[model samples]
Target: MLYTAYRKYITFFLILFIRLAAFSQGNAGGNTVQTVEIEPGKSINFKATSTPGSAYQWFKDGNPISGATSPTLNVSEPGEYKVLAQNNLNCTSEISDGFIVTVKTSVLVKQANLSVEKKSETKATSINDPYEYLITVKNSGPDPATEVIIKDILPEGLIFKNMTMALQGKFDYNAAARTLTWTIDKLNSADMSELRFVTEAVNPGSVVNTATVSATEADPDLSDNSSTDTKSITDLTIPNVFTPNGDGVNDRFEIKNLEFYKENEISIINRWGNSVYEKKDYQNLWDGTGLDEGTYFFVLKVKNATGTWQAYKGYITLLRSKTAQ
Candidate 1:
């Protein structure tokens, strides 16, 4: 009977020892999982081992997790993640080291350059708005970029009054689309140095129209600014109409909105094709008051925009009427 009791005791002890060992190890205790990637809509798995009867708890911050009984969890923002294991026998394990979960902006801007050409800069066009600017960009990376977008941010809701892009020659513009695109091979190291573009700010605001470019890609965050600057362009246009009325409503019989025209002239002729009045670079009108009434044929003679002298002959009928007695 004594020998039998001793054997029974040894057997019981062995069983207890095995149970303890298993509990101490926990099912996935020692195995380590590295390189957990936490993307926007993705989850990461941490394979840990512990006893089959052990309880699992996962934590986002320092607080205890409720239903996080699993070893994996999907995270979206930047924060700490950890897991803890507890055995049924009241044994506990240390919290796993915290892993960082981070989310990044998908799009990136890249290879942006700003070039300025000064007018009056010798052979650089000569004027107050002496500088001309151009913008260029590329997707010089391993990933294919999609949703490629470019924005010219100007202050006060000002749009690009004058803007252009440069191809080897020039690409046709679809003004309705507001989109400029071309099928380009992978931009690897093939910097789009040959690419050039132009745009001007609208008003005299504190800032110029700055450009920011981006696209959707595998690693969009890698896209970023190449360079930035502020430059000016010729902001000019011809007026709509030239008033020859004396009341100043349209009093000037000069070239309407001709400020941009470097060379100009105006001439008033008589009824018999005889030159009565002439003025070069004239910016005003002829009231036809101090003169006699009847059919006076006026000729607009100028070395027109095409560098050719053209005569626009028309009759200015002065009907002896109105305030000028």
Candidate 2:
């Protein structure tokens, strides 16, 4: 009986010892993560060591990503990303240290320049005219650029009339079909990003139009810093016709575009070499009353449209009604 009791006790002790070992291990079994990384398209995965029954959780920008309770995360966009893994035995593993994974976009315009022409500004050459100003914008990057947004600020007497490419402007703006558009797919490095627009100088004077052309990429991280340029609107044109009918509107008989003429001299003389009207301004006119109710000889001394100063002779007829007395 004593021998039998001793054997039973020994068996019980061994069983207890085995159970204890397993219990301790189950509670403190090292459940720790090894590595974490982001794959293409913002996907994430992690490897770890320890208890079974995998529990996966992903985080982005300090917010728990839903449905990411696995060892891998398949994301679509870009943001701060991380992951956590645990085992089924209620033993949690240490989180993997956060690593940043960013998807970048291609570059748009690389070189910048300005041009002067008739009616427009452009980045490339299509139709060069002395009657228009063309400001050239060239993109020397390898990446295919997205739709580009161009905002051109105009100067006094200079108004943007038309654009060769698709574009929009303030006041007369179209938000849907706005600015120059380049696909965001893939812009090769040696590609050109350009926009050419036309302008007309109203009422003649000195005009300087400043502008900034920016090439935009679709990606947020690599798309904010855009390209820029500055240009001037210089087209020296002279007015072709003027009327002096004494109607109080354009009543002055003088050169139209005399502002940019540098130096202008006008001489109106009678038949006896008597100067009746003479001035260097655009607002000077002779009513033809100094010679009486008859024909009077006149001469004009001024510069021609080609910047040549010379003399031109003409005649003026004055009629006096008897009812004037």
Candidate 3:
């Protein structure tokens, strides 16, 4: 009876030991899966929880990855990754959750260039004369550029006339700030667009137009994004000396290109500041008939369509010829 009881006790202890060993191997903690992103030509490392005397087998998309039996796996592609853990006793744990690795593409703005040119009706521009501006934009990108926009800041001493574009886009102009805007659709790689507008020089000076181009991407180089062009308005020349003797050759003190300035005021002042001749609209028909041969100061002020005025002052000489009847 004693021998039988001892054998039963040994058998019970052996069963308990076997059950505990199985439980310990199966109860191994699992690793928390995570998602990772890597750049092109790069790889990401995934490591599972290390357990002594345990072996690992990495799988991808439910298929075992050959020779990936270590506790760590290096992958580059974008797909689901998982690993199985097993102990010496052949007790295996459930495969860990999938850790996704995504490969990211690099997209950036390769190039952005803005160019402008001016075309005028005459070689020398005068006040109130229209000048045509040609604006061109190009994108030499390796990727598509979306929502491309171009902005132009129209300078003072000029008025906006009209705008046109060769490409499909939306145009907007602000008279108060004298700004023009164009918004375009997606611009593919090596694509180009053209825009044109007309403006009139209202005053005599240098007028500068500045423009810029941009898109919804990383503009690595911004040096070519903006461009500037300038146009100069010729100075109004008045005959310093005119012999208004009715000869029809020098019979009038004519101001060249005065007809272009419709909204203008002219005044002739004597040496003592006494106004001699004054007119709201001077038609370049000033003939020295009533005034004597003397020196005079002339003041000319012109207003633009936006109701802005510019003034010019200079000296004039009126003389009578001896051949006058």
Question: Pick by lDDT: which candidate is best?
Answer: 3
lDDT of 1 by residue, 46-76 (tens): 4444443256677776776678786445455
Q: Against the unseen true structure, what C-alpha lDDT does each candidate score?
A: 0.44, 0.42, 0.70
> Global lDDT for candidate 1?
0.44
In model 2, which runs have C-alpha deviations exceeding 4 angstroms?
A: 1-131, 163-188, 193-196, 203-206, 214-325
Q: Please say which candidate is ahead in TM-score: 2 or 3.
A: 3
> Highest TM-score: which candidate?
3
Candidate 3: clashing pairs of residues: none
lDDT per residue (tens digit) for residues 214-259 in model 2: 4444332323233333332223222222334445553334433346
**Residue-pair clashes per candidate:** 21, 29, 0
